[model samples]
Target: MEEMMRSELVSMSSYCRRYGHLKLHDFSNPSFKKTKYSPTKVFVVSSSSSNSTSPPPLPQNPIFQSFFFPVTPSPIIPYLQHCSRNTKKRKFTPSSSSGSVKVISREAFNAAVKKPSVAVKKPTVAVKKPTVAVKKPIVDVNKPTVAVTHDRGVRKSSSWVKSRLLGKGGYGSVYLATSKDGRYKTERAIKTAELSRASSLMDERRILKRLKSPFVIYCYGDEIVREGTSDCYNLILEYCSGQCLADVIEDNQGGLSEFDVKLYAKDVLSGLSYIHDRNIVHCDIKPDNLLLTPVDHRFRSNGFLTKIGDFGLAMEKGSVEYGNGCGHKRGTTRYMAPELIGHGVIDFAVDIWAFGCSVLEMLTGVQVWGEHGDLVYDDWVSLIGHSDLIPNIPSWLSEEAKDFLKRCFVKEPNARWGINELLNHPFLSSNQVFSHNGFIYE
Candidate 1:
């Protein structure tokens, strides 16, 4: 029995060595029983069993049966061949009925070992920017190019007719306009200029609309008239039948009496006080701009009313252009105040200075600076800007008149008297009464 067992063990060892790819364990080793692999049924062949009449009875022990199974080569041979062809790790599962091993494929093993798949990200697309439309400014035809208070209704061109040309100047032409339907009992004066050159007229219209006084010329409204092929801007105003103060002075050939001067001064000062109270400065004040309208006998006998006009160079108080020498050339050089010509300083005081110059011109039929004949523009600027120079007052005038003129010609505008103070001066504040028809002035 021991010899037969030795021979069978030697035969199994030789078969394992022949098929080394199968990696079969040596059954003769003691550690083979203690391996982690589960117990599997294997078939063994004896070296001396080819022609035996009957196979030896198989082992009856279960442990020996697991290692040496007497099975035909058909089933076990094919399974071993498939396992030898594969390269992946092998897993064994014991068959319940036959106690045989089953082989797992490389594809099945890879599927079990695969990691969880990651989500794929989509590609980004480019976006476009939108275009914007630019808008142009819209201009209203009815609106004046320069802004002003239009308290009165606008008059149409067909509402009035131009009877004749009254005068013309840098501002344009003045016409005697009569209402076609006689809506206005008195004739209306219309100052017209080309649209491009009507800014000063528009400014005058703006200033006049806010001022309401018997001494200040009235402004009805304004309109745009088409003349020939060009458009013209028109300022509707109150017409004065009598001549301007400059014309009156010329006709007289000499200065008027103190009584007439006093009356005119009171009227002009009243208008100046009205405008100055409203924070307006008349940069240009002269005799040519004053209108004398003859009053009816019922109101006053042989009396004429004085109205201030031509506000083309007027400006609001504290405006940036007020004293910055903006309209210096347009303003009468002789009437410019010392502060205005020297340092571009201006205010209500400058108007007082100009008023003094206007009064001096009224006392004498000649211009205030007419004595300096043919002096160029720069020389006049130098002369007016001089600190020591002042307008000459006539020696023949009364002490009150000379003193009144002195108050207006002060070199320092701060020291010069205001309209309120001048109105209270003895020259204008006379106790003597003058009565003509029913009109009385004291």
Candidate 2:
């Protein structure tokens, strides 16, 4: 019986596929059409004949067919029962007229119980609920921001007053901010970006919190400020009123005195030493990234203190091993090492190369690429081979200072002197006194 039922089901499916428009309609009425939700197969019919009677022979042309009698156990009932058992319960109702056929919706079929057929009414229209205004999420002003890491000083954005725009770049902008709290004396520089730029900014904030060095910019905390629709992130960092080393050079008629260069370079090297010791590389080391803070009373002098800033391009040295190929080029173009430009193996030496370029620019008041006023790729290629094609060394700079730069400019990364060696060089030693904190001297 099961096998016979399966064969009938397969045949019915085939028929539906062959004639998708096949549907039961009143043969006496040509105007009748099927509805959008009408079933494709299995037309039902009512008969006054006994249950033991077999259905009358189906006409060869279905368009002219008419039901004469009903078969025992109605062939459709067993099939529909099997289908309903295999699937879900559905509601169904048979037509009232003794010889009329009925169509039931899938929903009606699923909801129906086994009983005598009855007329089904059309579904009614449903009313929708009224909309209500949604309020913005209320933030607890007392709650502190807790990111990937947490610190005690983290506070709400409302507590800080954003003053003027300090600077702006691809990552976003830096604004001068002051705390409303009287305990906060010094102004803070808040680096901000839209939520779309959260990843890089968040990474920087995490890194800043882990670092603790006098030469590196200090991070206080972070906060999220809500705009009309979108939110923005604000990273609080130590503000350097004296500005960047690049600006300082511009103020000094495009170049710094040899003494000043040595002093600033020592400060940069101190930061680099601390960073490299922790296995991190400051990939984008340049004058712009070296911020100058005014000398405190302890180091009373007109000279400003240099600190490394802008750690957006920093990366852990051994995080991911690189195969023998050019890695992605990162960092300022003018300060890029030859290997960095060629997509060669990158390491701490790249920072050393950039430091050399920065030092040269400070002394000569010229760009690394514009050293001879006619810089070219060929010059870089020659330098990569240990050729004596160094950047133009000013005659005013002592030979010791020139030699110290040459050591930093060595094409072979392994041959280049590191931060510790560079710090101890005679040139940097001439102006700066070591052993103050013993951090750099050690």
Candidate 3:
């Protein structure tokens, strides 16, 4: 009986493959792409006659089609196959119903994705709750928002036209939309994380809301979108017509000099200092996050108008300490700090560490670490010693750059000077231009 059943299962699986591609109504839904769902396959599961009293024929199930295919499971698989062929005998009834498939609902099938027998590893994800206690941003009572949103900050309807997709990010999608009157237009960036929820993301929203600086993108709104048990949220923002620092330098070929670089760095540090004073940590800081505006009279007053953008990886002070069990690791790996590698407690200096890397790139036309820049962190570390951690400094870079780097990239986070002090440094205060190729920073 067992052998017969095994053969039946194997045969049924094979039958499914024949018509598996036949058009079946909506079914299979890949959770990541929520809108694009795929339904389960339908197969002929009935016998030839409607009145036939015989057992129901297990029409080849497309779901189990993999088993029907000719596959040598393994070295041991050969032995099992031989034994099964010799010992097992099964009977199968043919079905006459037109071949069709049913796509299993995600609710039922999400339980055992891929196949049976494969043990799945459960991930640790935060179950974020909506904070009714928190107040919404102060929008003009007169300027209309989505109706009924004034109470709980929840949109009464999905009237927010996706508008044009401004940009797609790792966590969320961005769109460009104007107010109902076209008087105010802002860039709406939605943040999403596959492995986790957006509870920890409020740090960015909170920081952006308080900021009223020309160097920071103004956040216009915040809301959450939920699917099943998982919920995703986004931050609506004021659009900036500008190029990123990464693109600016790349287009400039190599790196920008002491003057333009310093100007960019100053504005960037000014933004960072503001974030620090507000008790926030911009954990993921890089040239790409820096936005450069078009030569407008307002910004032409300042050299390269650099503004800090994207705070998806930010955290509050002391949140990622050495002993904390948050297991939260976020930041660009190339520009990441040594302490943030794999499993280590990190501090605000981690931001400084990344800034040191960025400044080094500004000075030299290369990444502090990574391809087209330095590929290995150890090489840079070896070149620039962890002097504060050691009695004396390592010998590779000039005393000037080395000393400045040591002050910022301190091994211990607490002793590091905050962004304000770094801004006050002589290196940034001077109107200097280190030559690059033959063109000076005009």
Candidate 4:
């Protein structure tokens, strides 16, 4: 039995070296029949007959014991499979055997190889978590929404929404607004000032309230607005849809027409007459303060309405006592009168001086001292004396108009024409009748 075993191993080794990839199954035990494993074939090289050729000599006893006897079925089968796929043949010199070499046929080796044995484990199904339902939030429709209230303890008026800023001054800013309560047009202006500077706006509000004329800016009322953490005062006034007289003068080629000048002069004098009768003096009177109403093309010949605005510097006559000739010279430099610069007696005559300079700008397109530097009392005197030297004064201007301006430009405030007197002047009264024939009057 040992000699036969040696002969079988020698033939198997020879075949393994040639077709090294062939696998050898263990059939010595009955447990392999029921066990599970991958199926594979044990290949054998072709031999004519077992008795024809001698089997190769077996390797040394140590090499033989290490290669076959000690190896278990698990490792030897895998080694056989690995060697079966590798086609390279290994050279082996077997030891000399006593008995004749018995060659193993291909059919005999294949019939001896048994099927593989390995059991496969079945896969398991994972357990899933149970599902839970969620609840939705519910709201009541009968509940009233809370209105945002300010800290001033007064409810905000829904009448107007203040929007973009139109301008800014020493007190605060003026914003363009839209009316929500139909109290006024969507386009209106709102002036605001904090309590720190609210005194000026409050004074202007009082002055505007006392006066009501087509030649004056209209006022709505005063309201408190919450600006950040503090309260602000808002003085809502009429919005002038037209440009200022300063812009009007700039647009006209060589200044306004003589007829236009006369019409505007009449309007300004009318406003001044109304205010002067009330003992109020508009301390600041300049082209910028005179605003023209929107032009009405249907009555285009009548032109636009002119009104005196910006009463910030106005004061009632004889209200504030002027002593020591130290009154505040609060007005534009170009339109300030000689008496005003000297800190002399200030009265309605100051407005008359500014009005004269404004008229000159209308007819001549130039300020009184625009050509002269730092308008001194002497320069003013020389300016009125040489009236022809001034540019933009039409040669056709009536002598009555020149004389009217001369009275307004007088050095003595007492001798200047009163607002009422200027209304009856030939330059204004005569121009009114001539306007019927044509728009332009020489």
Q: Which ten residues in a row have the lowest lDDT in candidate 3?
A: 33-42
Off by over 4 Å in 4: 1-159, 163-165, 182-186, 295-302, 320-326, 373-397, 431-442
Give the number of the best model, judged by TM-score: 1
| lDDT by residue (tens digit), candidate 1, 1-442 | 6676666666656644443212234334222123222223333233232332323333354444345533323344444555756754555443445422355666787887895677777777667667677786564332336334243332234356889998899899999988877555668899999878998898888688889999999989887766777767888899988878888888877787777888788889999999988888888888888898888656544468889998888877655545453444446777888877766666788888888888877887778877777676678778887658888888988899999999998998889999989999999997988876567766
TM-scores, each model vs. reference? 0.64, 0.59, 0.50, 0.56
Question: Which sequence of candidate numbers ranks them by lDDT, best first?
Answer: 1, 2, 4, 3
Pitting candidate 1 against candidate 3, the one with the higher lDDT is: 1
In candidate 1, stretches whose alpha carbon ends up further than 4 angstroms from where it belongs are: 1-158, 182-185, 297-302, 319-330, 435-441
Worst 10 residues of 2 by lDDT: 63-72
Question: Compared with the true structure, what per-residue lDDT tens digits does model 2 show for residues 245-287?
Answer: 7777777775876666777888899899998898777789998
Candidate 4 at 34: error in angstroms?
99
How much does candidate 4 score in TM-score?
0.56
lDDT of each: 0.73, 0.69, 0.56, 0.66
Worst lDDT 10-window in candidate 1: 29-38
